[model samples]
Target chain A: MMDRRRGLGRYGLSLLRFWSVSLAAQMEYQLNLIIEVVASIATLAGGLFTLSLFYAHGQRLGGWSWEEALVVLGLSTFLDGFSSTLLRPNLGELVKQVQNGSLDFVLLKPIDSQFWVSLRNWSPWGMPEMALGFGLVLVGLVRSGARPGPGGVLAALLLWACGVAILYSLWFILAATSIWFVKVWNATEVLRSLVGVGRYPISAYPPALRLLFTAVVPIAFLTNVPAEALLGRTTPFWCAASAGLALVALICSRLLWRMALRHYTSASS
Target chain B: MNHQRSPAPEPTTRPLQRIPMRRSPLRIARTLLVSQYALMVEFRAEIVLWALSGVMPLLMYAVWSGAPAGAAAGVNPQQFARYFLAALVARQFTVVWVIYAFEEDNLLGRLSPLLLQPLPLAWRYWAAHLAEQATRLPLVAAMVLLFVAAVPAAAPPLDPMRLLLALLALHLGFCLNFLMQYAITMLCFWNERVSALERLQAIPQLFLSGLLAPLELFPEPLRAVALHTPFPAIIYLPAQLAAGGPIAIGPAFLNLFGWLALLLPLNLLLWRAGVRRYAALGA
Candidate 1:
């Protein structure tokens, strides 16, 4: 147990180092860094502005009030920010690496290749979005008057983690397919468009579309469930289901990644 | 005859410019269109996927039509549905992706070769986009059909004259949108990161261009701003016309044509300046 704990600590240190390296590299281009930060903030603000426009005309969209909708929007932006910052810069490039056989370097690393590929690049540019999104979520909760107790807050945190897991797993499956499909580069785009659906509360959609969001794509768990938790609307059953989904997704993605590695005949070969 | 017998001059990049001279502009465009069509057909599934990416209006439709307070905004379910469905189709024609193509070319130093051609670089983008739009028309029609079948009440009675006008407006809108994006993309010559610059324009375009809601539904102050801007001429005018909404046909056509005329010259000026800057940088 001691040895295992030491190893885990070492791994954590290396991951921290990786993130610092990315930050250092980004800071080298000060103009690009500034622009990225500004653009991210603008994007988040633009989203909120659109929501304000909608609410300017009506008190409630579907059944949710503007504050509740803001919560969903904030959560979605946060997850999307996380994806763009960490998940996208890394996994989005997996297809090109596979095509060029540069993935060999990743596979040869002593560290877990999946972890390396997924978390290697950390964009400080997305920091503004991350900060804004968290802020919006707080403001939304306050404005919406949902005073969740400790248990509810904890549950929301857990479900939010599960949502991140699901999103990461979905991206993993897409990246793994790059081993077989040469032109699946746009797969991430498909993921992006689907995620855009989560910008609103799931209840806002028609019955057919809502079913598709929750069951087929499960994007509702990514934003809606967490927002719902904050609003004291989440049932115990949803919390368990979300946790279960995340575990299953992560495991399946691990299996898929391993299988894909086996099929990666190096471009040099 | 004697010139042919003379020893050939030293091969230079100048020769490349003349090689493209052998093909007429029309012939070159035809070939480019053919290849682009083939590419679009090859990526039919991807094309459909891209078409589905137009989710903004769909989301707007859901909000404006489903909400109880939507009627207060002068948008009943039928009007909201009709407006968004038409906007979706119009957007299929008016959307431009030249920013991505230009950015990639400039970053990879591949733009220099494109500039070497005798014809303007915009022709290549125009051909590709036109071919993609032409090829995707059938799919768009099918989508409109699917939407109409699903919501019969939203399908307004066909007004032949209005639709013809709308199609004309949409075609001009396509040209206007393409030229505007091309002009914006020309900034890549000076800026290293144009995507951020693009978002500055894109955010406004999203809000003001009727992608979120019809211009009439916007707050009164914003509605006035949108009406004056060229952004709405591309989407709101054509969509409103298609939905058979109360739009003065004479002024709408004039607005579209006026924007097109203004953009064409502006694009040409930007292209010339951008190319000069690009060459100065040895790119």
Candidate 2:
């Protein structure tokens, strides 16, 4: 037990060091911070404008009220920001490491390769978007008159955690494929574009696409399910299913990474 | 022969300044197209992934078709599908990556070598974009056929004249987009990271360019304002024309030319200033 505790403590300390170094390096470009803030604001405003178009003329998309849909949009925006902060920086580095055989040094380290590779980089540019997304969610809850109790809030947080796990697993899985297809850099772009559809409630899509997003991509869990939880409208079944899917996805990503390493002959070998 | 003789006579203590032979514009264009196309074909796999990333409009169609707004706006599901499919094609053809390319080359100091060539650097990027569009054609055609096969009712009857006109609008739209982005790319001479500015430009392009939903669905004031911007001329007008939707051809062409007239001079000015600035910075 003491050994396990030390291991956990070491990982925590390593994460802190990793993020601080990257933050310092990134802070050299002060203008980038302002650009990121403005770009995120513009993006959120444009998203709100598009969302408002659906609600114009007294229409609800797939039976989702305006405020309810706002929650989904907020969640989507938050996930996008999260991706920009964590998933993109680390996974992009992973692809580079694979191309140049720097991953060999990573494997030689005393820590878990997956954990080190996945959590080694963080960008502060996504902070404003994340805050704005949380603000929107609160506004949506107040406007929609859905006051979640303590238990409801806990459930919502848990489901959101599940959503983040699933999202990370999905990205890591795709990034792992770079080990085989070294030039599959743009594959992540395709995934990002597909995830853009999650801005609306799953029901807003046609039945066919609804099924595809839910089953094939699990985008429904990424935004809709968590939004439903926030609104105090989620069922126990969905909560359980979301947790299950998140677990399955996380496991799959781990297994795939392990399998991919076996195939990694190192660059120019 | 006159040029050769003059150059031979100038062989003195100083090195001769050879005046390049005047080549036909057509020949120059053909050579640029062929060489760039060959380069593009080598990266066909990455190009295919890039083509698939343009599935935004198609996804929007799936939502809009089922939404009540389509019915309220007097556009049925079939029209939504047709419009978005055409939008997908329009966006595929008009996509510009000049800013990304230019920023990279400028920062890596590759632009100095490119500028040393006799050809204007803009034509190289333009030829590359045209070649990429050519590479994308077969893949986009396959996607369209698959969509039409899945939903036959979404297929509109092809009008020969409108088709020709839509082709013209599409190419003009590509030129306008290229110029606008190339203009933005010139800022790389001053800023190391101009892609952030390009991201800002893309926000308006996304909301206003009829990529998310048809511009017809936007409220009156917004739609009118959007039409005035250069965004709609890039996607909305050409897509609407190709989809057989009602649009005034003359006014649409006028809009394209108007923007072209404004941007062409702006690009030329920026190019001259940027190159001078670049030289100073490099020195």
Candidate 3:
């Protein structure tokens, strides 16, 4: 029992040190950090602008009202902010490392390669996006004209946690693909399109599309499903379904990740 | 004189004539395409990824069309129809495939092989892109036509003559885009992180190039800026022509030609200066 605790302590401390180094790298560039912040804000504004264009004519889009759609769009933007801030920079850099045959050095280290690769570069620039996302959620709460009651906010957080999980799984799967297909930047653009689709009310799509959202892409969980919970439009079934889907996707993604590592071709080739 | 130099020369013995009747330009282009195809075959998965990435415009179009049935913000549902289909076609047509070309050229420093050839390096690059067009054209056309068939109301008139003009405009637009990217890519000769520059430059092409929505849909100052910018004449102008608008064919081409002529010279100069700097520093 004493040995187990000592091992756990070392693991926790190394993780903290890794995160600190990642944060240091991210904060090194003052100007790039500012540009990243502005770009995220611009992206959010672009989403709102598109939403406003729809609202200019009617009270609703397809079947969604202004408040509900706002929540959805806001949630989508917030989710996207996290995706870019956390996942994108590291993955983009990893692609470069793979292409240059530098990934072997990374694997030689004692730490878990995936854990180090994914968590190695925490962008201090991401702080602004996190803050902005939180701010947007608050604005969305106000815009929905309903004080986000504790239960609803709790539900939103739970759903959001699931949403972020879905994104992590999605990215891990893509990264896993990189273990076999080293040059994989081309497919990364698809990730952007997937998130872009989440910027508006999913109701604009037909039932077939909704099925696609739920099953194939799980895009609805990433944004609209959670936003629905916040706006009181979510059914109990949706919350339960999203959570289950998130769990399953996460589990499979981890399995795939392990299999990928087992098959990882050291870049020495 | 060379004809006379051959021993046992006969009628029609000139080696140039005996060779295939292919034009020099045709031969150069063919060689470029064949080599490019060979590379593409090696990385077949990347090609599929590129084809799949074009789906972004489709997503944006669907959401924008979700606007209320009537005119919303000066664009009717019908206009939105022409706008998106045109954008799709434009996106497919204007793809310069900077990824493969830049990756190999910069990372490997293998551009010297192409430069040593008689062909202008630019033509070789264009030739590879053209082969991609040849490979994908039939499918892309079918996809666009399928969309047009779905919404006959939004179908652009099949004016063969106007389409001819649109094709010319499209070519010139592609040239301008190529030259613009060529100029910017020279920065790679100096800077190591071309990816960041590529990302920053690419964002505007999607937004400012009218890929997301028609220039007419952009808000006040933005709309005017977009109109005056050369990007719209590339995508939006062709869109007007395709929709059977009485777009003056002459003026559009004139503007396109003017920009092409100017940018072409500038790109050539940049290439010369870039090569000098590249050689001087040996990066």
Candidate 3, DockQ to 2 decimals?
0.38
Q: What ordering of candidates by lDDT runs from best to worst?
A: 2, 1, 3
What is the C-alpha lDDT profile of model 1 across A59-157, one tens digit per residue? 777688998998999999888788878888888788889878888888987788888888888887666777788889999999989999999999999
Q: Write the per-residue lDDT of candidate 2 for residues B16-95, one digit (tens) a residue.
A: 67677787778888889999999999999999998999999988888888888679878888788888888999999999
Model 3 misplaced regions, further than 4 Å: A1-8, A23-31, A63-70, A91-114, A124-130, A180-183, A261-269, B1-26, B69-79, B97-100, B111-120, B145-156, B219-221, B245-255
On the 0 to 100 scale, the lDDT of residue B81 in model 3 is: 73
- TM-score of candidate 3 versus the correct structure, residues matched by position: 0.83
Q: Per-residue CA lDDT of candidate 2, range A114-144, in tens?
A: 9999999999998889988888999898999
lDDT of 1 at A29: 69
DockQ preference between candidates 1 and 2, better one: 2
Off by over 4 Å in 1: A1-6, B1-25, B248-254
Better of 2 and 3 by DockQ: 2
Residue B267's lDDT in candidate 3: 80
Better candidate by lDDT, 1 or 3: 1
- The CA lDDT of each predicted structure is 0.82, 0.90, 0.71
Q: What level of docking quality does candidate 2 show?
A: medium
